[model samples]
Target: MKNNPVNTDLPLFCPREGCVCYQSYDNKITKDGIYITKSDMVPRQMFYCHGGGHRFSETGYSELFGKHGSFKEYEQAAKLSTYGISANATADVLGRDVRTVEQWQKALGSKGQQLHYFLCLHIGINVLFLQMDELWSYFKNKSRQLWVFIALESETKFWVSFELGSRTICTACRLVKGLRRLGKWGDDHILKVTTDKSAAYKNALANIMGDIQYAYLQIVKRRVKRRLVTVKKFFVKGMAEDFSEKLRTPPLLRD
Candidate 1:
């Protein structure tokens, strides 16, 4: 029984995602005594709903669980991992198996990703002003390099979409495509996209912004040694101008 029990004062809905129980649905859930565990003699709460014959437990969805550890242990394992503690250390601290901690971490991560996607789906059309950037990281001993392309809605400061791949034109295209699917662009619906001076950015924006109304610009920072540097703007798309003219009006350069 290594499942995290949800602390709830009321059985809000059927734990099953496919269940059609309404909030107003009369689910007279009655407690059917308890089952005492043989090992610890801990009494587990059991519930039964007459509607749909839905039966569940306090520590589980539809049955008694948590044979090994409780939800607190699962939460502790998750928090330990978040605090820069490795899986082995988290397991040692929680007195749980290392593999169990790892599995909980993965499940929590997947739930977080699902929540993020759910929030993204609820973002209205008002979310505009796109910012694109790449984060470079290595796996384990730097054996495999991973490039994460992140697109942010600058105005709302909300994450639009992200893609994991090598820093390439195809990856950039995929990232842009992900952002474009979020909302409509062009004409009355304006979008200002800002990014660093990466060739992939140019290719991606050019390929996507053919009919869309968007202003794209690259922020170019000229480095002198390892000290402070000067910044300039390079126009990419939505508006056409000579390189010299584009540099003159930095404020007007960005859409």
Candidate 2:
């Protein structure tokens, strides 16, 4: 004789952007009894209610963890997946494949590229505050390093030029290219550029600003506490004395 199993119920989550709450339901019924389960038991396809009516279909879920799949499911898994939790651990908890976890990471990378593009395209304003910093990544075992150079208006916070770079020269070049892209590369456009005492930055600034006969600019170096010798500041005083008056005030906030 064949042994029969009992019926079952499962819990489900709405794989939407900002939805919460789990609904419980019965999955199957058999000779034994009933059992419960979760909705994320499988990949959920979502749909939108377009037009004036409520019509929904299996569209797709945003890659909260990756390019596609349930956002909540991945988030739930990510929290556990880190701190030495194996991929299998997360997969089992979320009822997903270990491969899916990797895919999510890839999707996040793609999104970062998109953000970088946007930061480059939209830049405006009078003053620019360029900063260089690094972000640490545990998975890569190395820091995700970058130089963020931006040309921004001091008052309105409008960005004129922004670039993310891996190399100092590349970063400097991007700063130049970004300014050119906004049609603000001329001598009169830049009021001041505050930066650290990087030789690449100094060389790049001189290359760009020195060409103009009318633009006066200064490069101020913020000192590191532990360093004994303070870094020297670089400035290009152009022919225009009127714009030079605005150079006295420091652009960055004191920390």
Candidate 3:
């Protein structure tokens, strides 16, 4: 198959901040020719930051450089791995070596983490109806209990934030505090929050109310004689809003 340019013909610039090499988007940057190779003869665009004489590549900080395959190949492996395929299997399917697949996977993961940090710190998400839940599992001969606290934005269905600790109020607070950076809260912007009837969620969210402003609700499920009973909607914090009417009882997956 024919190979394309590393950055898909996008204008390349030095990612370094305060570097004049970025230019004013009008000044022409000096093309320093290809800097590296991967699989075919993938040309890496090189530019010299005239101000600092700092040179950078079109694939600077890109996940495509270190791996044996091209950026497209890395993406293909990632797509197949999503379907429960292992690195080795994806490598075989892609006709690339297994180590190359592993490198691409790690590079993809690092890129995701970097993006998440940028969003969490620089870009705040204003979410309405953030669903909170925790799943329980035991590890090491069932001696250690592992609880994963998850906060999901119902409107956009984005996994807003998460924390890992025992099902304790302290851990819940840590997760809620992280939500403050995620985005603003209001019905006009952010609205109600949903969570199963967990005392920890109530206490933690209440404590953070003075800091992050938003309405909260709880979905309490009751079972009688091992039979499914009534699912009660209860107010956990703040005055209920109009969207509360839209809150529906979700099917119980498991305890």
In candidate 3, where is summed lDDT lowest over 10 consecutive residues?
Answer: 1-10
78-183, model 2: which lDDT tens digit per residue? Answer: 5664465766776776677778866765565455554545445433222333332222223334465554565555444455556676656667766765565554
Question: lDDT of all predictions, in order shown?
Answer: 0.66, 0.47, 0.71
Native-to-model Cα distance after best TM-score fit, residue 227 in candidate 1, in Å: 4.6
lDDT of 1 by residue, 26-143 (tens): 6666686787654334577776666657766665542224445555665676687768798889888877788877777776666566556655554334444677888886666687
What's model 1's TM-score?
0.64
Candidate 1, position 97, lDDT: 83
Give me the overall lDDT of model 2. Answer: 0.47
Q: Which numbered prediction scores highest in lDDT against the true structure?
A: 3
Residue range with the least summed lDDT across 10 consecutive positions in model 2:
21-30
